[model samples]
Target: MRNIRIGDYLVEKQLITQEQLENALAVQRESKGTKKFGEVIVELGYLSEVKFAQALAGKLHVPYVDLSNFDIDGEAVRKVPETLAKKYTIIAINIKGKRLTVATDDPYNFNILEDVKVMTGMDTDPVFATRTAINKAIGKFYSMQNVDSVLEGVQAFSDMNNAEDDEESKDRVESAPIVKLATTIVENSYRADATDIHIEPFKTYTRIRIRVNGDLVELMNVANVVHNALTTRLKLISGMNIAEKRVPQDGRFTQVVDGTTLDVRVSS
Candidate 1:
């Protein structure tokens, strides 16, 4: 069978008009290789991301994965390193015998399949998923590792500086572990496509949760000592008044993740 082009397939299926395809093509050209044709169409509002991905999967004769409801296999996720998965925007979702099934937004990129196969020593099965879904899965799965060590580091840092004055504590908030904790929380939240990140203080510990797909999922809880430093780091980056904690404050910051700029709004 001859490989079907996404644009031609969409037009043949009446999903998009020829005029819209041409317009998207013009936009893609204007991007000067920065964007793919599918990306241009989605960005141009001609097709929803999921719709485009499904159409592309049908055209490519590959299975389409709805990652939002999919139960990811932890063993499969471990087959692909986080760095490799993030680099290629692909995630291993299942493993059967010598075959590894991975989901990617760009099923047309056979190079990703080959790279994964070589890295994992398995026959690769490529499936289609929306970029957002794959990104969210990557964050949700990969970020779950090493949590205990991270919290331990935070506790150690906080313990060592417990005797410091307020000014000194403020300076220590920029410590390596604290910085990593704050950065990880924000970056993970962004990659997970979370609408809100909740950091709540309780009597004993601080709870961290993120709202994804309209549901709140708890990420982790840390010592109350670590909470002050973590929130301080976040406030510093978001330009909030760290000293004035009694009043509600709002701030916004921009983060660039995997070449995409994300505007993050913070409330405290």
Candidate 2:
């Protein structure tokens, strides 16, 4: 598949109103493909960026950005079997004598080769192309591994990260002030006695809408690009290949809140 922005893809496909297309396209051109379409639209004069981001975020099946300031690993990288890593893209910057290197589907990210070299204190190289191209290259590098299966496992973990099958709501909705996404959804569900929370994906973002009492209500919004990053991070955390996205995947987990153990299920 092409490493393309879906707003561009949707516009080319003629799948939306020109006004909508122009709004999205304007956002894309302004960002020059760096800032996400969701963010750009908000900056430009289009729909209320918040609502649009929320709807788009839900459609994209990703989480919203929160106000909390927690430590996040900035330089996060995974060590896959070089065999598996090389299966998807070509190692454009293969410094024969260095320990750390940068790999990206877009060779353009490699435009700053000198910067990377100076910052990391290691030789810097770049990989350019699509996930499919990288997968093919890695397959040639290591002929025995099943890249497809590895990808499936990764998607499975994405499901687990986003899933929610927690406790049953008892109908007495507690009116303690609103909290985070998880808390709001869980609390609303418990009070309304809902079964599942459905998250979906869109072109340039993901929406965090909730389903309670059999009705759907938009909750929070997040950029599609952010969601994409999160899904990749989740895959890496669950020991799955981050470069593969050809198939649907599922994963699940559990959390204890208020002395109650609840199951969370995620899928993509």
Candidate 3:
């Protein structure tokens, strides 16, 4: 979909009440005329500058620019090796017959694209998106690829480490419950590709936090009290008393990523 402004989009999406929007609009019309929603929102105190930026970003459908995208010039991608491109998660999004559309928050992504053109002899077009939007889209693309399933990938990793079979590892596959939970989190995380897992105290709030390359790229506030259930389940699996939370605890478990099992530590 083409980019749309977040305030207008949210109003259209029914995410904010019409009255609230009207108030914001009224302030904007009075204080600033013809300015973008972001600027006006910040001036009128409808939202904090950071939040306004974030919302405006939602409207812009671009990830917030950061050091990662800024560091690589898009023009250089034209000469960058395809092997390196894939390894680096560098890709052309809108590839047509002869021309490819590259979406990135970084202007430098275009430089990279230019480098790729010289190396592979492919025509490329550079497009810009917010870091958040690009990461969200990329995560979806990778999930569709399904390079590895969490359980199978973890088991392979364990064997690679020559880790002997233990009760936990042996029953890992058999315990459909734990596997299912881990798989859901990992899959959802990959889909959103969020940086952190937001475990809030809300009853039905399941927010997935993804930070790609060191920025908070996506936040999926899923409306289902999945956190309570998942946290409880995790506590039980880790041999912690589910009913107790007065004391802070630390524990960890292993899961697979990219055909390798990696340890995922839990902290409260």
Scored by TM-score, the top model is: 1
Ranking by lDDT: 1, 3, 2
Q: How far off is residue 245 in model 1, in Å?
A: 5.0
Q: Residues 81-132, candidate 3: write the lDDT tens digits.
A: 4454444345455445666555543334556766657766778665554444
Better of 1 and 3 by TM-score: 1
Give me the displacement of residue 164 in model 1, in angstroms.
Answer: 8.2
Candidate 2: RMSD to truth: 20.5
* All candidates: TM-score: 0.83, 0.27, 0.35
Error of 3 at 236 (Å): 6.3
Q: For each candidate, what is the lDDT?
A: 0.84, 0.44, 0.52
- Tens digits of per-residue lDDT for model 1, 1-268: 5577779889999999999999998888888999999888888898999999898888778999999888889999999999999999999999889999999987768799888988999998889999888887887788767566677888788678653234436557889889878877877787677888999988778899999999999987877767777877778888999898789998887877655788888888
**Candidate 3: Cα lDDT at 115:** 69
RMSD per prediction, one decimal? 3.0, 20.5, 14.8
Runs off by more than 4 Å, candidate 3: 1-91, 108-110, 118-120, 143-146, 149-184, 187-233, 236-268
